[model samples]
Target chain A: MPETFDSPPRFDTVLIANRGEIATRIQKACRELGLKTVVVYSEADRQAPYGKTADSALCIGPSSAAKSYLNKDALLLAARLTGAGAIHPGYGFLSENAAFADAVEKAGLAFIGPSASSIEAMGDKISAKRAMIAAGVPCVPGPDTALSDDPAAVERLALEIGYPVIIKAAGGGGGRGMRVVPEAGLLQEAVALTREEARQAFGSPSLYMEKFLQHPRHIEIQVLCDTHGNAVWLGHRDCSMQRRHQKVVEEAPAPGISPDVIRPVGRACVEACRQIGYQGVGTFEFLYEDGAFYFIEMNTRLQVEHPVTEMTSGIDIVQAQIKVAQGDPLELAQADVKCEGHAFECRINAENPDTFLPSAGVITSLALPEGMGIRVDTHIHAGYKVPPYYDSLIAKLIVHAPTRAEAMARMREALAGTRVDGISTNIPFLRALFEDSAFTRGETDIHYLEQWLKQRRAP
Target chain B: MSAIDFSDPATIAFLTEALTAAGASGLEISWPGGRLRIVIATGNEAGVDVSVTPRPAPTAQPLVVVKAPMAGHFYPGSPSRQAATDRLPSVLAADILGFLRVGPLLLPLCAGRAGILTKQLAEPDALVGFGDPLFEIEPQS
Candidate 1:
């Protein structure tokens, strides 16, 4: 076992346990905070540029994520061997994995994220909704109780919630294990089909029901909390531009919505975190329709689009998360948080822009935009190989400006300046989206991206 | 690069056979960085000869590749600072060499067959996804 860093030991080094852009992003945060970083890589990512810049780098495992990033034992051992005091699971893989967090904490090293229990609770959609309701947070019209096997009770409950309800699995998230019931007659059949699918997909036949909003916009509130019971919401972002539930673009201070409209929701989310003693950075996702926000699932980890909120609020969220993990108090209060500008983030993925198929190969040449209000979070460079084994996301091009229009304009300029060769990317699609009138006016819903893509691809 | 279809049993089986025949003592291939060789062994056990018969690299052309057996972070030394026995300079094949820690317990990260070169892949502690590289070795004459 590695020696524990007790007695108020100052942590000067962090071991990043994931790969790609998030790894580079976390390393930058650590460097800004004057901390050294230790990076690990798989065989497939041997030429990653981020490894070259790290204070120390090592080969952990093979290209498969299961043996590399997901190997909890290996990560702890690295921290033990390198004298690293903390492990930052940037996102995906083991970021929200409760067991990994528990193991890290048991090894006497800080897990730079939420507590294991919080992760467990929020990882399950039903449990999270229950917790949110318990803390007086508004949830969608869904019963807190699990669905019964009785078809009659299921039909009765669906009637009470009204028609056009959605049947969802308790263990489901990311829009899986769900089926929409259009009317009263379809409720029972939907329930049965969803139960079977949920059982097959989530390993649980248990499910819940909710009113399926046809054109709801996706909005989310980012929250930060310390171990000292202090928690605050760090503005909001609109992630309505999605394809099949996966967010394609996100912007902060969701355009056109007044602070009054979102203030109560944000407060409720913060209160929920405090009530549950939640720690680290988290996101409360919601569906906004009919001018009211309906609570959805909570993500108990740093979100991918966190850069947008960071740009708008000018807060180093990753640094704050690390500080919180090190048992530090919240330095800035809710009142101290002053969101100054609008920000937008476009996820640049290596894929077929038309079919959205992943495109993997070595980057022959690359150029990223520089200057004020423009930030590129990525690990790719000229000659860096984009391995086909993992996610297609290659970079996140984010911009901040005094106004939404200015931010949009800056994104246009930044996108034009950026160039990545030897692999197909979504840059062209994003550039075209920026020119769309609906997108410019912020008058689009969750289905807008898919619909736009459909129209563009139609013969 | 072509995507290795891991879902197909044939890929895994072929890889297992190819790895065994590579006779590179041990080889470490990493994503982000590419490949590394750490020759910790001497004689026939220490290397893999790609040009000739699929036999391990002979000492006359000392070159051993230390490939990762699984995916995880790779460590090259022991916890205590006695500075573990060096793998370079081609020690006897029976010599006890460096280690790789998975989490708590230390797993002996061997140089199995021997050689002289000690090239490393992945970093000292970066998160190496599966099949990442660790070391490469070129045997001594």
Candidate 2:
């Protein structure tokens, strides 16, 4: 048995400040750990099935997310009322909010995530890049500092980086607050426009520039750290299948890259996590191009695409995060970490396949596939009402196999067996993408999905 | 069981008051001695008149539900007055019905309309979220 730390703060109950499938997922993990769970819901989700299974459930507010899920005080109050010793922010909403994490800690309840300072450090794009560079991690060729006010210096910096460069806000992520200038002529104007937009949006006008990789793939490394300084990277995932800068599909082992090629980057990520004293689970997002990986940003919370990594590594990441929060040391070292099989996750969104418009209504009928190598994570069921106020993602369909090809085949079969009625979904589009020759061949960039959709629309 | 004395006016008046207090329209007690029927008038005119037949259902009085303005631990009344529920408090539109303790802040919950607070819907010291009903009031006729 691994040596245990002496008398760390242990929590017996956890309050999940999230909704939908993730809430159900966290409750399951808490139950397995012999911990009680308190599930909070908005009026829109009062009928959510997960609420019935929790140790206790509370209605935090009305249908608006701002008045409910995103309300920090409401979540804290709910935690206090339910006698929960910890709060689990399951991605999205307040998951990445540093102030919320700090407030949770201040309230004397474990935040079940990294320290607030760590979140702040990683939230800023420039500071995160600097930390990555300091840890000897590969990053895009650019100075690890924000752009100066002088237009001439900005122009010179862009020229030095190369013809095509991207100016990004220091406080931005999720593909927002960025402008790519292909040549020097548009550099100053792009910088000015982005600066103004950044000021209005992110509360800061600071900007940075980087050499743009025209055809880079979005790859991410999942890392788990404990309070005892031990950290390990589970594996890498390819999330290049996206639309409107939102990932739609993800697969683990990031096909075609060998362990030898990725091990160095993974090691650097672990080093970076230790350097910054990051705890719990985080994802190091990188852009891979021409056999080289460049660090982009790090998500300081569990990711929506975490299931792919979980399937490939055979690790329950949610449980691991909770254990780490309980002040447990790493049970396994980097050498013990193994990436076993390939896995793919398709985000089942409640939206029109053609127009991508959200479809929210009662699910009149439903059927999910269940067999070897197939898993469905969802809180939706027959007669479950899909609220129009939140995210469109209703479920995640994951499949795993010994090889990528087999995983793909299993996913196709699973998708075929799945059925949902009374609401439009992107299942048809996903089925078509699975049959695409290029996607089946395994390598596609972030822009491939949008281009593929456009081509399909052409007469 | 002994048969009820339906011929007694005292028994009939007692039954009429019971139906009025329970918010029911009418009640009929048929014993072997005789049948006793009572009906109450169905309007804002507040008096129970004993009659021999069922009258129309009572008109519903408008009610004002004092809801929580924010999420916090609910106190039925101020710290000095802890037994607010023991006696129904008559309140004006701006009367303080309770307080919502959120962290260091204590937000006052108003009655929002003039009425007799007929019920305390939320338990004292229970956590209440925004718009959760705390008190139900029947507006004065």
Candidate 3:
């Protein structure tokens, strides 16, 4: 039965259960939709500028993340106290937590994301891979089952898949609790170690193995789905500039890849979202190698790199996610989706440009670039204290132009003009990176940043 | 013949320095019912004088704070109840000074010590997190 507009659940106020730039971003979206926003914060973020602008701001807990941002009970209590009818988890923290989503729904509030069941299904690597394969989304060659405890069977499976297999925890993501076995001799130890780590970390010892690609680009397809079963892919992003498994920079339309190659992948992502009954915004991460796409996992939340796709597709993804949460059907069909121009997003992190250690202090002075086709999403200003307790990403500097070269040039100009005083930033490193010949050429693999850093460090 | 600890040069020096830093002419601190006074001379070449006396009777105890044990809406009493003034009633250590209403569960706010509830710190029904002060208690004998 289709949900009619009159019968659909509607909410007037949204409690933003996250912090930093995403909180500011969500608040903007809510205000534009004529919905009131309640910004909840930890003690450390009591003075956050967004809090002052929100309809209602409350301190939920102390400075520690576990007691504040990650506290499910505290978040629910805040939502109830503020009279908010819906919650926008933003990203990170409890955004991907299935139990929290279920709790919010049980509390008679809308969780502005996918249903808990979809999150649970995709949270497990084994089940997620099976679902992708069943949906005709390309996946790495491996059995969609946990590795057996029998050492001989594990070795046989590894041998069948060829050497250089990766044993990953079924319950782990974000590049943790995984091990790579370059040869047969190290397979058992790697599995045992990863299994033990997984059990301790994710409370699951179930492990799976897959063929580890040596040189694959990190390309991801962004999709938006509604409760009415409509889904569309909003182009693709190449977040191949990474350091320590974290993306430093991202660009849309993945330079050098023709639309013919990525069109099928995008369609498959949309199909997968529809098959799983997924709703709201999500990303289907893939490893691109040898002109083929292999599904890695699906992030059932708004990604940090979503702005790049938003710039190219000219879509307000956050607002779309909110509308879908309100039981509204997608306003645009697949045929209406058009990705134009080239866009780049540089994650400005508060860290030492050399050592990459977090630098937390007051932003004594600030200057950000402003021009046509440039957007800066940030929750900071002069005198805003960068708290050390949270993620180091202080802002996202995005630029879009008619061509990739122009976008790169604009980014270089933006980086040069950007200045954050009283703390170290990765601005200098980013400036140098934008000038690199290889990066300007595009199509760098996921390991390019680390190798480049190493080359720079060598005497 | 005074019971002052003249044997410990460090104690006398510390007292002398504290008195000089505070810009007080003299200070008399008593222990075991005996008082020792250090007086500073006005001249550039300052001098000190020590004397002893008997101590006086003790005074009243200090005030204590009643804090919220958890985060929730604070209620001074039941919804139907009313108070004549903002002042809170005297409370026992285990008395229910207020309640932290967390989703239909009201956890009692205990004074945790005997005292006169002199002031209500938080507004009634205000959302407060853990450790927020709800009432100020003047400890009684």
Candidate 4:
């Protein structure tokens, strides 16, 4: 077989096959790198600020994501019509899609992320855990093999792994198609229920088992690799401030975890990247509990929380990813990389503050916070419609300072400065959360945010 | 005083019934400087909203529908602009204007009607769907 990482790619244009904040973010990166960008938007995003700013913007389909952002064929067709040399999935829609990545490469276009094989490897939790273990990365204890139909085998494995195990579908992610078993008595029923749910949700019956850890924090290491045999870990992030398993707030250099503790694991992630010949940017998500790291999965695309890492390290991750796709070698070694400051990213979603239900309407007025060390990544403007058909995230308000306390203070000020009118926003909720004593202390875990909300809501 | 949420099934059904009651199989919803014409498909039993307009939002420029000759990736230019202009502006009726490379074969796509090429609607080296626009032409009378 030919060497996968051969010659460098030569391209000056990229098609952004996404909408909202990430689309604008990718376009800015492309422009800074002297690359032209073509933006493909749905009808709902007709008046989006990013579309007008792009070199070329085209309407792909209707507002429904199925016809617009997730329409693989339409996106590819848009790329073809626009003369884009490559396509940037931009974190959502088709970002983690293995088949879409394969199709892009097969159609003689560069996929601005990891190879299809790498994506496929990480797509399945079972295969990903096994790979991570092989690469000497710490993982939650569980049977590595795929689940069998035999009841005896399932029960034996569950007993061996101990109680409170989680039965997860191979194709599951984003807290879907999983069941937690507290005891052996409920094991079979949980497995059977999860299998049916998996078949309906992810179209896959393949299931995997893992030792469920309570109160584990969601930490992730950011890695950037090139076509050449070079990789660098860009430090860690704590996305534990989540509601309903969806991240609402993220911060770089996860609070309280010393560099000495995370460094080795980060190095292991870099080694795994090189071992797999991974290209572009990828994130290794881990569950941190009892001062130990357990690999969960790898996001083979630019993460939404990338800005927090960028703010702390002063590294333009999107630009770096684009450069890697352009066949650039690693400019700096592991030693050259150093995180200087603390950074936080608050996802400003267009949703109800109470129920968290998506609130869609025209943003009649928008007053975005702006100042030194504060960055707002968004595609929304005054009069921009917050469509109900897609993710509720409207913008990412990021702030960086010398210390975590300073960063938090800066975030509070920034949050106060933000004002979105004619539509409900979660700004009020974020403001309260920032003022909370536990959140300010940075001792919260994955379930902390939900629990906090419940406590606040208690009559 | 209120805007309609088109995605709601109730709104869609109401709109369909309203249109049918008005003795119009087709209805055009117009906002300030924008228009959306919904036509009832010929054979669709339930009057499916499949016939949606292909407008690129509201712009000041006069709308000109650019029709694609064949399905392929839209490429605005071949090698260079000089090359594109030389081949495009001087092409006769029978001449091969440009090629749309579908996989391996370079299929020849022609300028069916004589006109001044106002704009190249598609991007260079882009994959185009069947009947998707490639170029905008100002027809010579």
Which stretches in model 2 have alpha-carbon errors above 4 Å? A1-8, B1-62, B72-91, B95-108, B116-118
What is candidate 2's local distance difference test score?
0.90
B1-141, model 3: which lDDT tens digit per residue?
Answer: 455584356777887787778887876665654445667777522354444444456777668977776678888853434531255666678776778888878887777888787888889878876667788888876
Order of candidate numbers by DockQ, starting with the best: 2, 3, 1, 4
Per-residue accuracy of model 4 over A1-459 as CA lDDT, tens digit each: 112786645788899988889999899999989999998887778778888899888777877898778888877877876788899998879999999998998878888988888888888888888778877889999977789899999999988998899999999998888899999999999999999999999998999998999989999999998888899999999999998889999999899999889999998998787777788899999999999998988888899999999998889999998888888897888988989899999999999999998999999999999998899998888878888889999999999999999999999999999999999989999999999999899958999999999999999
Query: Could you give candidate 1's per-residue lDDT for residues A1-459 as a string of tens digits?
Result: 112223223477899998999999999999998989988777787778888899877666778888777888767766776778888999888998999998888877788888888898888888888889988888999798799898888888888998789999998888899998998887788888999998999888889988889998999999998887889999999999998888899999898889998999999999999877788899999999988888889988889999999998889999999888878889999999999899999999999887889999989999999989999999888988899999899999999999999999999999999999999998999999999989999948899988998999899
Consecutive 10-residue window with the lowest summed lDDT within model 1 chain A: A1-10
Per-model TM against the reference: 0.81, 0.85, 0.86, 0.79
Report lDDT (CA) for all predictions: 0.81, 0.90, 0.89, 0.83
- After the best TM-score superposition of candidate 2, give how far the Cα of residue A313 lies from its true spot, in angstroms: 0.8
Candidate 3: CAPRI quality band: acceptable
What TM-score does the predicted chain A of each candidate obtain versus native chain A? 0.96, 0.98, 0.98, 0.98
Answer with 2 or 4, whichever has the higher DockQ.
2
Better of 1 and 3 by DockQ: 3
Interface RMSD, model 2, angstroms:
1.9
* Candidate 4 wrongly placed segments (more than 4 Å): A1-3, B1-141
